[model samples]
Structure formats: structure tokens, C-alpha cells
Target: MCVLIKKYKHINTNNYNVLENALTYDIQRIENDLKKNHNSDYFLIINDEGRLGKMRKIQRINYIPSIIFLSEIELLIEDSLPKASKNSRFIQILDTISYIVYLYCLEHFNNSRWANRVRNKLNFEDVINLLDKIKNNSNIQASRTNSYGIVHYPR
Candidate 1:
């Protein structure tokens, strides 16, 4: 596995609208790329920071199933309390974004031997519920500690 790092300044909280728009565009682009590049393994890393730099790295590498980071999505949902009008639609957007990723994996990789081995582990509902709880400020509990260390989920 290759790890690449890039540096960037922190984002201002007030600019979330711009961030949200960018994320929406990137997610759609990723989905389209996945459709066109069916043979590549697309790995998207979602986090609250370092999104642009990571995206730039992936673009430089010219890798397929392009890697993307959903930092804007996480920031818009987790950094502030949800409000009416503006932030309310975040949940729906997140649902659509994650569903696209999940659907791509299921439909494109289903025939792969490794996919069959790990099919039971791919659950999109868990992701949606986690985002919902974050948006609603509900209690979230630890689900399981996989080889990836500790993982949390909405109970």
C-alpha cells in the first residue's frame, strides 16, 4: 500500500456552503468515473480534513476508481448543529453520496472472488444511520474493532 501526504490550511467554518457544493460535485464525478472505469479499484477515504490535497494526489497518480475524501460532508454534519433550511438537506445528500459509493462496489465488484468473501461486511445502512445520529446529536456506540482498529456506529 502506498501512502501520500499533502499539507493545507484549515477551512473556515463560514465557508461550509462552498465546501458542500464541492463535495457534491466530487461525489458525482467519482460515481461517473467509477462507471467509466469499471476495472479499477476505487478507494475513497472520507475524513474531516485534508480533502483537497488527497484528491490532488490521486489525480496526479492517475489511478482508477479514483480516491476521494468526503471531508466537506463530515464537516457540514459533525462540526455544527443541524439547522433548518440549509443544513437540513445534508442528511439526504450524505445518503445519496454513500449510496453511490456502495452501489458501485456492489455492482462492479460483486463478481470478484474477494467481494464474495467480504460481501457480508459491506453495509451501507450502517453508514446512513451513523450520519443520521451525528446530524441529530444522538448517542453513538462502538460497534466493533476490526483489524482497522476501533470502529463506531449508531446504536
Candidate 2:
């Protein structure tokens, strides 16, 4: 299973503590804590050892308080899929894909400073073309940060 462990950078604190070095120990702990309470194929470990203000981003996604939260997409599917009958999975998959696309667009637009340079000429069709370019290109994270930073485009 692919694991995405989100580790936060220490803020003002200077303590550098190493976590688990062995997979056996970690897997045992996860099994006892996660599998015992919840069913999941994969675990997303959210580490918030040092983050303070930055924790807001994580909290906003969950709408709850937690030092760490584990989510099982499959289990969530098992529970919520019935609401849409036969097409639930397809809809859910599409929604997930669309969100990824939106974030990719945001990352690209934020990086390019296209808003400032071409905002005057960018109509709805032009904006869609920008989205197409960002979606087509695979290497987006390494792109440059916008000189003017990020501005939310109004819907």
C-alpha cells in the first residue's frame, strides 16, 4: 500500500526527534490502533508535531480536531456509495479527479503570475486554455512561484 505521511516543519522550536526506524514496530502499532477500531486498506498519517498556524489547513479539510486522522477511502465508499445507487462510485471518482484538476489549475495559475500579465485579455475561454496547459504538463510542482503570489479567481 502507498503511504503518504505528512510531516510538518518545526516552527520556532528546535527539537529534532527521530520517529520509528523499524517498519515492524510501526505496522504493529498501526494494526493495533487503526485496524482494531476501523477497517481500511491504507493509512494516511498526519503528523503535527511542530505546526501551529499551519494546522488550520488540515483542520479545514476534516472540519474536526485531531492531532492525527486516518481515512479509509474504501470504507467510506462502503458506507456512502449506496446513496447514489449504481453510479455512486463513478460520481465519487469523477469528483475526486475534478478536485485534483482544480488544485492543479490553482498551482499552475499561482506559479505563472498569468493573472497579472494576461488578466486583462483573459476571457473565460482563455482561462480554460490555461487549465488545459496545466493539466497536460506533468511537472507542475517544480514550476516557478508567482511574482505577485496567489489570488483567488472569482467564480
Candidate 3:
């Protein structure tokens, strides 16, 4: 079986930037700990070291499927509907897709920049195309810092 270790919080955030090599040692140590105790067949060790956030962007789409966050999605829409459907069916689908992408971004980081961007859009359909581009290509970490850098998400 594969072992998933969320080492980001487990490691002290204050030391992460200076502990790159230490993190590698920590991974091997975790693997050994798993093999010795938990599972001998722990062939894969997936570590989410938050410092190396950029590496996860491409692979996150494969693992961050929206099905698992169904309940969260429900809560998200509990009080939230665009005041304009108020528009077309196409607009609705695009809104749904953007919400899904926002949820995906939320998985990686706790920031609400994506939701805020959607909230602050000029019109109901303002950022549909931009949201589509962000869906599978970007991670929330990037979305947070690079807010103004992204297309259509201006300051």
C-alpha cells in the first residue's frame, strides 16, 4: 500500500526554509518507520512539504478530485447564488466549473482568494474563461501570492 504523509505541519514551519536536507532525511526516516512498524509494503511515500509548493501543481489535479469535497461544496452554495441567473444556462455551467476550480484551490491552501476573486468580479460572466484556465493548471499557493499576476484578477 501507499503511504501519504502530510509533512508540512508536522515539520516546524519556522525551520522549513533552512531544513531542505533535513526534510529528505525526515522522509527516509518516515519510510523506515512505516516499514518497521506500520506496513512493510509501503512502496510510495507522498510528502506534502509546503516549502516545495510549486511541485504539486501538475500532480494535484490527479489527486484532488472534486467528488471528495461534496459536502464542502454544499456548504459553499448554502447562501451563495449569483444574483444574476439572473442569466443564461451557459453562464450557470461556467459558474459551476469555476466553483469547482475554486474548491480545488481551497484544498491546497486555506486562502479564500479564489472565492474572493469570483465574488469581486465585475459581472456574472467576467472571469469564466480565466477560471477555466486556472482549473487544472494552477495551485492555490500560486493563486494566493500571484493574485494580481493572473489574468483578469487585477488589483
The number of clashing residue pairs in each candidate reads 1, 0, 0
TM-score, cand. 1: 0.21
Task: Please write out the lDDT profile of model 3 over residues 62-81, one tens digit for every residue.
Answer: 22212233111111112212
Give, for candidate 1, the lowest lDDT window spanning 10 residues: 1-10
RMSD of 1: 16.9
Query: In model 1, what lDDT does residue 100 have?
Result: 43
For every model shown, what is its TM-score relative to the native structure? 0.21, 0.20, 0.20
The window of 10 residues in a row where model 3 has the poorest summed lDDT is: 71-80
Q: lDDT at 62 for candidate 1?
A: 38
Per-residue alpha-carbon lDDT of model 2 for 26-106, expressed as tens digits? 333444444555555544433223333333233223322122765422211111111331345655654454444444444
Q: Give model 2's TM-score versus the native structure.
A: 0.20
Better of 1 and 2 by TM-score: 1
- Candidate 2 contains a number of clashing pairs equal to 0
The lDDT values for all models are 0.36, 0.35, 0.36
Tell me the alpha-carbon RMSD of every candidate: 16.9, 16.2, 18.5
Q: For candidate 3, what is the TM-score?
A: 0.20
